[model samples]
Target: MRQPERERPTWTFLTHHARVLLEIARNPEVRLREVASGIGITERTVQIIVNDLRAAGYLDRERVGRRNRYSLNTELRFRYPTEADVPVRRLIDMFADRR
Candidate 1:
């Protein structure tokens, strides 16, 4: 017999990179440690992801005082060729605060 669905699926739609981006999009000054806690991930992992994003031109990091600040490259399109034309701003906007 078929089994019932679990309370939560094992897979998620948004990638860690996407999650980090969205988090920063909402609050540019947010701390990476906070992002990790909010995302249920390790701070070191978040740091690695941030490095990847920066290397890929998805994010720009600036050191403001003691904490680092992030800025998204809104005009930059997705890396995947399938969605290369689609700017990441659309993705960010899709998950923007909705009330």
Candidate 2:
């Protein structure tokens, strides 16, 4: 029998960020716990990545009661393929209607 492909190391790779953003975009109201579970990464890493994205002007999230509403800026250009197709700012705007 063939063995299953091993999971990739998220920290060592950059595509993880894009993948994470896509997931968040799919469900703006996704919780940290759910994100960590869905992405197969630690919550700490999720927090770090999220902070990095915000710092890079890739995303903007608003506080909605106890949860957050995220927006994806699909206009700003990204330096890498991890953000090639979509703009960082566009992602932030996706949640504009939430708050």
Candidate 3:
């Protein structure tokens, strides 16, 4: 007998970059390995995405001893016209855990 195929989503509302950013926002001290593991991506990819975000001025990194810390530039406006007026912080807050 033939088995039925399982359906899976091919897309999501947020991109991998957004997911990484949100993870960083939630824990500035989080490690790249943790982000990669949590998001199911490679550590190298996480590093690249982090570099992209830093280059775009969306994030700032500070070296502390052997570890690095991140700080989000929440005041920056969204890149798209549809949400350009909205601050990045608002978006982060939407997905951030309320405690």
For model 1, name the residue pairs that clash. none
Worst 10 residues of 2 by lDDT: 1-10
Candidate 1 per-residue lDDT over residues 1-99, each given as its tens digit: 323456545788999999999999989999999889887789999999999999999999999999888898988999999999999999999994531
lDDT of 2 by residue, 2-93 (tens): 22347543254436676567677778888867778775778888888888878877778999998898876666687768867766556435
Least well predicted 10-residue stretch by lDDT in candidate 1: 1-10
What Cα-based lDDT does every candidate model obtain? 0.88, 0.70, 0.88
Writing each residue's lDDT as its tens digit, candidate 3 over 1-99 gives 222335435667988888899999989999999999887789999999999999999999999999999999999988899999998899799995632
How many collisions between residues are there in candidate 3? Answer: 0
Query: Mind sharing the TM-score for model 2?
Result: 0.67
Question: Would you estimate the TM-scores of all the predictions?
Answer: 0.87, 0.67, 0.86
| Clash count (model 2, backbone only) | 11
Superposed on all Cα atoms, the candidates' RMSDs to the truth, in angstroms, are 5.2, 7.0, 5.4
